[model samples]
Target: MSGRSVKKGKRPQNSGNVLAVETKTTTTAQNNVKFCLNHMQSGFSVEDLSKEARAEFAMALFKRRGMTWTEIQQAPKHGLGSEKMPASSIRAAIPRVFGDVENFLVLRYSGLLPMAGVRVGDVYHIVWLEPQFGDLYDHG
Candidate 1:
């Protein structure tokens, strides 16, 4: 029902125009569902990422969900970083399961370091992403 509403069996045959019109699958075009759940509240904009970083953000989220912290940290590409968000609203936003909101885990991919947030249980609440740097310090 996306483009040119047609009957179930009325899809056009193998044609470039048909495929382009019917099977478009770019991230933004197809699914608006975000990979990072609630990390937007961590103080940043999604527009900050380059296109490559945007792609990697999805990749990091997919991988982080499955891998243990031990498994994820073993990769040379991954590093640990934190930001100081001492605000009460920030702590109140996350579920009580996230133990402490002092710091968060970083998943580095494609020169982008995305926050994996202070996850105590499973399911990470990803926040902002920073491009590669020697270290991350919150400017405030």
Candidate 2:
């Protein structure tokens, strides 16, 4: 009360004890595989896939939900091989945006269903879905 009296209508000053908080930001690595149909053409629709093939595709996606790209590449018995096919050799016309794309990531979801697309990060942007097997790209 004697030292530095507070004036009327003025708030009391805060003590000079300041605390500095150090925050550490962490980023999680993406390990799970993701899929999208961003590049799929209108001509290639899901309706073209047979009921059994559609179910197989869904089941394949479910099974690979926890698998990393590396695991998919390492295991060939599963049939979900992650192979790269030359862009020029692909049967479907690649999007203009991907004109400079050198290769397309091909994934065989089933015995006859081959999904072709580009992988950006962990998401596979599906461009073509060939239910007839070699229609998208030659297996030979």
Candidate 3:
């Protein structure tokens, strides 16, 4: 049996100088930009990138860690300047699981190298790391 004594729907009272901690829910925190690589395509893996390219990729992520998705999409040259890539514009076939994703966001990680991902909530799930421009899709 549990030793704690607390009434139903009632929080236990703090006896001494301890303060109760509550979690704050904020929209800004919820909308902050985050990146994930779980969905990255096999051939476009980061492991294949050259040493210089890899360093640039890490630096890019570090530079934008504090920005929100909106800020990343809105700023001028420094921003991600993401473009929409519809399925029709994509050269490679996406897995059936992501069939309903409709479109993907393509951004440059280094010079014109396209990094494609899907946004779910605040997380941008990386799907591809196209090292060469126009290799994955038409940029025209």
Error of 2 at 90 (Å): 0.8
lDDT of each: 0.47, 0.73, 0.75
List pairs with backbone clashes in candidate 3: none
For model 2, residues 20-40, the per-residue Cα lDDT tens digits are: 221244211235677786677
Model 3, span 1-140: residue lDDT tens? 69999578967676664423333574543366778988777777688678888888887778778887778778654246677788777777686667788898876788778788788867788888876667789877
Candidate 3 lowest-lDDT run of ten:
19-28
Candidate 2 lDDT (Cα, whole model)? 0.73
lDDT of candidate 1 over 53-138, digit per residue (tens): 77876675565445554454455544432233443433224445554566565455555454445444333455545543432334
What is the number of residue pairs that collide in model 2? 0
Badly placed stretches (over 4 Å) of model 2 are 1-30
Per-candidate TM-score against the hidden true structure: 0.45, 0.72, 0.74
Off by over 4 Å in 1: 1-36, 77-100, 131-140
